[model samples]
Target: MSDTRRRPRHVGAKLLLLILVCYFLVPVWWLVVASTKNAEGLFAGDGALWFSGFHLADNLRHLITINNGEYLRWLGNSLLYASAGGIGCTIVSVLAGYGFAKFDFRGRNIVFAMVLGSVMVPLTALVIPTFVMMSNAGLTDTIWAVILPSLLSPFAVYLMRVYAAASVPDELLDAARIDGAGELRTFVRVALPLMRPGVVTVLLLSVVSTWNNYFLPLTMLSSSKLYPLTVGLGLWTQLASSNNGGGESLWNLIITGSLVSIVPLVIAFLTLQKYWQSGLAAGSVK
Candidate 1:
């Protein structure tokens, strides 16, 4: 194609990309702006983007102090769930994926097929059944109810399996074996290091999913003390909606709480983004 003919198309594509970026980012921009304002300013501030106030500290203090600092507890619970689930899920996914990718065990194909099939199953659909099982086993209302289920991520397994198969060389495994390395030793020293990118990706995915999980925690736990950020914020919103004898606007607290709950996920993304991008690039190269 001639340069002149392609110029308009390029300009149009740039414009479309800009539009999509703004469409997705405007809400986040609004949130950052809104979080800085007090209850009155949030509703009264016409310039949601430009308006500023000194209520951020006050709002944060209130959020921390609400119901005797339950917000902090919720945050702690979320951190616990996300950390436990992320680490556990990453380990399980890596081991399972390594086996599937490298081993030649009997029924391997059938087992892989089953795992892939599980990936297609929606987690929401399994929540009730999972809850029933947890309840039967006397695990309900405990952190285990949330952590146990998140430890097994079918999608993570699939990702690890694909990445391992592509990135790990069979020759490397054989070389380690010849050098007097046991299977566990080879896996830990060789395969695991080689699969860093995939492991980081799975870790990020698992943490994010477990951090933002609402339905699972809600269904499994009835104690507010054990509630994660998602469920706690949800309960706050519900209370705000139901009560009217409030001094400060509960709506502001709800909005602020929602904003606070998002901070961890943002931090997790920023921290692990390099690993995910590098891993994906390396996997593609393989």
Candidate 2:
């Protein structure tokens, strides 16, 4: 009698999970299908969710060749920005978080409270203020304008603090101290290894945020040569929408560029998946 009752609940949960899977995957499937079609086929193709023809190669060729290969330049800029910002932000967050978790100092609560408060404020709200500061500092239109602002992620710091407090134990640090390990040595040799999972999580989040950043870069950079993929693709979209010429052709290129832009992020996630898997295994063993 109990078995019959549990069967329906299990079946219902599986059905719900299947529905969510389809909901997320449908758009990706559409993107893949649309990338294969020309602009005309994309809008007036035989099916919206199915491939009409394969023009992906021609579109990619044009994507790289058009405007002296501007798309490639944008791709490189994004890579540089994301890699630099992500790694820098991860370092800052880890140090700040570890300090907060392990040490006690006057005004610590007050400062951490301010950080937590800042997290509630939307990043878009701060762009104008950031632009003004960058302007005053003579950094506007330079890579520093974008990269500097991205290096401070309050949320990442908060995440690291929470993870550090939970994952790192006071007893372990005390043991390291009794063994004559200095604070720096203790952190690098003992605490850091245990914090690997949190570090990787924060790293991936920072990387994705920097890679997809658009509005801040848009506000800060005016030169097309300095534009990242987000800003560059946005420019193509705006130009394509206007009635100058070659609207549909540009649209095709835009679709292909959008598809190409996501490849690096996908590759990064897949490549780093094993680190997370190993981290989980280590945690389980402990």
Candidate 3:
């Protein structure tokens, strides 16, 4: 009788999960299908699910060749900004979080409260002030404009603090101290290994945030040469709208470019998803 009652609930849960997965995957499926079709086929085709033409290779070639290969440049810039900022943010968050978790000092609660408060403040509200500061420092239109701001992820720091407190054992630190290990050495050797899961989580979050950052980069950078994929893609979209009647034929390029831009993000997520999952599980266990 209990097993019969549980079957309906299990079936219902599976159906709900299937619906959610389809909701998320449908747009991605459309993008993949649309990217293989030419402009005419993409707009004229009756079936959006089926590929009208196989222009994936051609579209990719043109994507790389447009504007003397500026798309590739934007891709490279994005990689540099995301990689540098993500790694730096992860390290800073981990160290700061570990310190906050393990050490006791005057005003610690006050300082942590301030950090937590900062998280509630939307980043959009700070754009103008940040732009002004960057302009004053003569950093506008530079990679520093993006990298510097992205490096300070308050939420990542907060996550690290919670993880460090829970995952890192007080006995371990005490043992390291008794072994005459310096604080820095203890952190590098003992704390870091145990904090690997949290570190991976922070790294993944930082990378995704940096990769998708559009508004901040749009506000900071004016030079096309310095643009990341998000900004560059927006520019292409704007130009496509303006040149709708012209023979510039950017529809194919824009769609193809959008598809290309998503590849890196997809690859990064797939590759790091295991690490992220393991990290979360480890932190939960700790």
Order of candidates by lDDT, top first? 2, 1, 3
Cα deviation of 190 in candidate 2 (Å)? 0.6
Better of 2 and 3 by TM-score: 3
Q: 136-180 in candidate 1: lDDT tens per residue?
A: 999999999999999999999999999999989999999999999
Cα lDDT listed for each candidate? 0.90, 0.91, 0.89
Please identify model 1 stretches exceeding 4 Å from their true place: 244-248
How far residue 147's Cα lies from its native spot in candidate 2, in Å, is 0.5
Q: Can you list the residue pairs that collide in candidate 3?
A: none
What TM-scores do the predictions have?
Answer: 0.96, 0.94, 0.96
Best by TM-score: 3
For candidate 1, which ten residues in a row score worst on lDDT? 240-249
Q: Model 2 off-target regions past 4 Å?
A: 274-286
| Total clashes for model 2 | 0
For residues 121-193, what per-residue lDDT tens digits would candidate 2 score against the true structure?
9999999999999999999999999899989999988888887887899999999999999999999999999
lDDT, candidate 3, residue 154? 84
In the order shown, what is each candidate's alpha-carbon RMSD? 1.5, 2.2, 1.5
Clashing pairs in 1: none
